[model samples]
Target: MSFTDFFAIDWSGQAVERPKGLAVAHARAGTEAPEIVDRAWSRQDVLEWLEQLARDGTRALIGLDLSPAFPFHDEGTYFPGWEASPVDGPALWQLVDELSADDPHLSATSFINHPHARRHFRQRGDCGDLFPPGRGRFRVCEHGQEAMRLSPYSCFNLVGASQVGKSSLTGMRVLHRLRSKLGLWPFDPMPETGPVLVEIYTALPARLAGMRKGISKIRDRETLDTLLAAFGSAPHRPLPRYDDHATDAMLSAAWLRVAAAQSELWSPTLLTPELACTEGWTFGVP
Candidate 1:
């Protein structure tokens, strides 16, 4: 079944009162351009927006710029040497939800602050030494990403700008709440109707749009316009130099508008059952 709309979200994991980098964009069927749905959405704002869309029976394919699960298959589990590591993506998400049950508005501070799990992330200076040499950093999907020439950072690394740990951890809280309301790709089979959420890496679409490697962010209107035109989208108005969040969301939505129709994106030749069940595949990964 084809989706009636496409949506892409640029998520932020900052512990701010209101997230500034979060952006949302959408493209409806038959539209030549994708529009910015929300340029400054908070975590709670996005949750309510998605809930409303689900209630409205929107048949949309939602792409979130965050890892849905951590490195599991390579190490056999997320937490090495711990006997109680989650067995799969759903189990891991459930564990995060349970641990962060008391967090307000789906924030994952509780889980990130937990004594047992906090050591896995690199946010705290003392936690970096907890991980042994190089045993538990990447997942099978990440290895595939490397094969495709994309630099995939470990979700456990929360230090550098490329690190996705905080966002993925916070996204897990939202995913746990939305699991019953929306279909999560790879973990949950696509439903006949309603919204379906998939993990997306914006760099894939940016590269397809002719952006150079190591230059992931778009800072100029000309470059953004060229990227949009590659997807057959209409010309967009001028945007600021630092609006990478908006550019990522808009271009990703435009890319998904075309890519979602292809069966290869949904079922790649390399997608194994183990990878699909434990470490979820990025929707547009080759």
Candidate 2:
């Protein structure tokens, strides 16, 4: 089932007083007027709603004003840096794909695919299946608990100079698409665990339209930092508080780790035939 439609809702914690003041939007059909359930929903309430949708088999892209996955694990979970993280790209993406596959109409998307978010995942070695295998398509998962697959896909690790607005713009564009195509109004709930295809973009002084390089180019530290610092100064940046800090630290850490790893792999010796043949192999001795 394709999650082509959209829905949204305002989930601001306590600042909004009554649930009646809460706002929700579905693409077109839902109540013309806002629907309020007694009071504001807690995180558990939202999760339960999504669980029901998945059980019922809904196929739609459900947008939330909340951060589905956080960089830091709940309040006090220990996140040993990348060195101890067993998570690989395929493993993480597969989880997200499976978690939402059950809801034929219950799909999800977020505006948090910036370099910061990517870096944080790398630092903690804990990106929970953001990218799935097979040309941006996600697998369907009916079982709630299944082992994750480790398959590589065309994943985007958008790093570079700081404050470039990569996260905010990418997220906003996603929200815009969800609102436009899925008839998603704000303050709505999702009910499925199907696929959610995310689109990403970069921010820079020079135009980056039509540029298709490997993941290495986009995820460079200097470039990400330059962009991030610039975007932070922008008038409309909207990344969450916790995410903002986590992403920044992660991006910085990723660059350092890659640079160190690269240095360790370097060699001063030339690529001679002797070097070409590894030890313990009988080559050209016939």
Candidate 3:
């Protein structure tokens, strides 16, 4: 079964109800450049939009810029030494949702502040006692990403500017709420008849677009359109101020449209049945 539409969501974990950092872009099954879905979006807005996709019977591949699960293969447990540490990806999502039940706007700040869960993540100045040493624990697929000369960070680190911990936890809330309504790749298997959401690392496409490390973020329409053209897509309409979030979304969407038929991406050498179930694979990491 082939996908007819491709969507890439640049998600944010800011405290606001509608994060300005959140952006969504769509690309159809052709060479036309993908366009950003211009609007301020709350996490709820994205959830509802995806629900609409299913209702409309859209055959799409949705990509979100976040890790679907924290590292599970390292040390054999997510929270290691903690009895309540989740054993797998879906359970981790459920645990984050349950712990962050009171967090407003589908956020995960509450989970970050939880006494038990709090002990596993690094904060602005405090390194959680449980956070692994020496660059932190990495999922098996992330090692594959590293093998390809792309940098991959631990989803457990929350302190630096590039940290994905908070955002990823917030994503878990969405995944938990979204799984019943739509198929989540790896975690739910590739559904034969519906949209499937997969974890995406924008750097993968940026590198493929000829971007170098430390300069992957694009801030101009000219450079972005240049990359789009390389993907066999047209130029996107210019935003008032170009940002990495929008560019990442646009580029990934276009690549998804062009690369969806590549069987190697679906069957990566590093991806295993256990990792598919315990630590979800990034869609383009092969």
Candidate 4:
């Protein structure tokens, strides 16, 4: 139940080789401040890094800031009314991967641009007919996050800052590529050895650390270290810049170290077996 390292990824879905929003950070099993990885990373780079972590026999809990699967329980189908929707999270990941296999840099353009699948997403100036009425659907874990006053965006929403739709799809491709190389939580049971990756909403850590909904983003060394201390982590050395991507990665990685000790987080009252397989839960949402 203990991990040698805790890492958080501020992920992106941009089609470019190196996404500007991509960042990664890690905190070892100690009080030392979490460190922002001082390297540029592309989606492919992250995939290779994680594979190396697994191959090195590292015991790590890597939290990915993207939905593992789309809302299944609320609508009972990822693409409601479609006769050929995936049956579970793993299947959905597989579909996204296979469809986007030719997309460069792990991009999911092919899947999102697929004629059958495109109708279910919300794109700029072209809200698909099948797109939901409101802010789109929510998985059980996202609903739990909303219940806590933290805004949750649908993985099917591809427009606006609230849209994580494309990000989730691209992340699913990475997950599919990662299958068997490492364990994906809920979809694949927590492994006793190697690396275990879990879906994480970085805002969860900020909310728990006393930041409000409107301004949960950590922006300054003062603010970041303050929240880091709240997580029982030591003060972090000041970075030359405090971009939201790096700060969120560092704070969430720091928080994961603390969140791992609480047994209740490993089990949630609402996460039933079926939902766990179809709509994976966010790691810190107990």
Q: Which consecutive 10 residues in model 1 have the weakest lDDT in total?
A: 127-136
The lDDT for every candidate, in the order shown, is 0.82, 0.27, 0.86, 0.88
lDDT ranking from best candidate downward: 4, 3, 1, 2
TM-score-wise, the better of 1 and 3 is 3
Q: Tens-digit lDDT track for model 2 on 1-286?
A: 2243333343332212232212333332221221122235443354455555445555534433322222222112112333432242222223333433442222322213223334332212444353323232111110100122122221132223222222222223323323312322111222234322211111111112222233223334344444333322211122222222222222222222222223321221222222221111001010
TM-score of structure candidate 2: 0.25
**Residue-by-residue lDDT tens digits, candidate 3, 1-286:** 5999999999888877998889999999878889889888999999889999988878999999999897787677778777888878888999999998988999988889888877887788878887767788889988988987988888878877788887788889988887778888778857777788888988898889888777878999889988898789977787887888888999999988877888888888877888888898988888
Candidate 1 vs candidate 4: which has greater lDDT? 4
Best by lDDT: 4
Cα lDDT tens digits, model 4, 232-279, are 999998898889999999999999999888889889889899898899
Candidate 3 backbone clash number: 1
In model 1, state the lDDT of residue 42. Answer: 80
How far in Å is the alpha carbon of 6 misplaced in model 3?
A: 0.7
Which runs of model 3 end up more than 4 angstroms from their true locations?
Answer: none
TM-score of each model, in listed order: 0.93, 0.25, 0.96, 0.97
Measure candidate 3: CA RMSD. 1.3
Which should have the higher lDDT, number 3 or number 4?
Answer: 4
